[model samples]
Target: MPAVTVDNILTLPRIETPALTAVDRPVRTVTTAPTGYEGEGFPVHRAFAGIDMGALDPFIHMDQMGEINYAPGEPKGTPWHPHRGFETVTYMIDGIMEHQDSNGGGGTIGGGDTQWMTAGGGILHIETPPEHLVMSGGLFHGVQLWVNLPRSDKMAAPRYQDITGNKVALLSSQDGGALVRVIAGEVAAHQGPGSTYTPIALSHTTIAPGASLTLPWNPEYNALVYVLAGQGTVGVERRPIRSGQTVVFGKGDTLTVAAADTQDSRSQSLEVFVMGGKPLREPVAMAGPFVMNTRAEVIEAFEDFQAGRLGSIPAAHESL
Candidate 1:
């Protein structure tokens, strides 16, 4: 049985149109900290990696992983782990990733593909590089985001969705200078392939030099943009941003991204991941791999994992 409750999943508000008259929202805050390595030695840059879970409610963690190139036989990846009360979204920009879970779910996602896994009640899963890739190492680049589930659906059954690049909704600027890939919400009247427990707009946008694109967004949602590559300006304020930087937006129904106008700029294109979601506005209790509304529930989750009630992945199903 699914762990998600009907009320929690069904009541999520959908934004079919802008709630406020379109206005160019300005950049509110910018975050850029040093990158670090985690998850079995993988290099990562995190967004809101701190402990204050409520600050990014409904969006717990975001890790931009491994833009590093590995020599032959030097690849590294994560081992098996358990999780609950949230969803894990892995979006690959380059290279490949293999995944195996307790529920007999296993697959490989390559460049431009995505895996959205819901660890509602609980599940043990492993995400790693492919065996061949480990043998003959290459480049690896991807991002993993943890989206929190509502209190009422914390114990819902787990699920998974593997979305290939072609399956994602794609939109482009009128002059073909910008492209947007809708991963978990609607863009240009097209919805993403993955089903979401909460209302969220997640997109991978790319823009060429001297180009600009405006996106309509939900006024009530908290919005943020993380620059993946190149330099660009965001919002009406034209807040300048570069790779490895994150820009938080203020209240408004529209935002703009403009690539550096100079043709001789170091970067030819600007790539970013745009994300926004409604805040849960509820207390959060989180431990390693577990998230809940209260400390008691978090304790119970750990107990369940220790008791093997969360299920375990078969060793044979996991790849290096």
Candidate 2:
């Protein structure tokens, strides 16, 4: 049985994965960080590597990579904000994040932890980097994915998934991990947190030098790839996809990958995050820090915030 409750979050049933279709070439050179980025605290580098999610739908954005540093009592973090009609999935590589949301769901995710926050109709929340990076180099590195919600669930109740590494089952082999289960999409032997809301498959892996892995693709949903660690070549029909890049796939059943670097993964695993869903295909009007489907809606969201209607959010020093 699926993990469903009074929450009404239904995940698509799992099915058999098909064989990967090869492309003409491999992933080529592309812009890694497109959107402007800002660094807070003592981060090594803080910047965006793709289009601001406020635009794209179904697959809004993939934060190629982030390096979060720490400094005690600096209070370096984003303040309370509101998000409507979308979800935020944060996967951390190093360090922890203390998250608190208005939906009564929040927690601190340590290294290898995953946090999925669905800001259905509207959610007020804040995230702060752990104080560890402040002294002993509490560093933070990870990806923040933005997935657009369908009209039906746009205003639904907000929810969260505190996925720990221990809770997640890893499928590997002699070469390296075959799959690092993110939110396994009905796939067997792979299960990540937050599968109840979105039928999504998220994974982080290290394909050894000259290693190759063919992954399944969902034609019903849009597809994209974000490379984090060493350089690589996506086979069948991609260019030289290197670290810090995002790929907009055309159409296919499976994705084939070959390590671009033959000198072993010194940099790290072939870290990547793939996500897709039914498109919202509606007018998107965004302002300073909020995203809405239309201009009027955006105006109303700001108005609500000014009138103290956004809702209570967590803070670095405030009580939850």
Runs of candidate 2 with Cα error greater than 4 angstroms are: 1-29, 35-56, 68-75, 173-177, 184-191, 196-199, 263-266, 314-320
Query: lDDT of candidate 2?
Result: 0.58
Q: How many backbone clashes does every candidate have? A: 4, 20
Task: Judge candidate 1 against the unseen true structure and give its global Cα lDDT, from 0 to 1.
Answer: 0.80
Query: Model 1, which residues run further than 4 Å from truth?
Result: 1-21, 50-55, 262-267, 315-320
Per-residue error for 311 in candidate 2, Å, reads 0.8
Error of 1 at 84 (Å): 0.4
- lDDT agreement with native, every candidate: 0.80, 0.58
Taking all chains together, each candidate's TM-score versus the true structure is: 0.89, 0.78
Model 2 scores a TM of 0.78
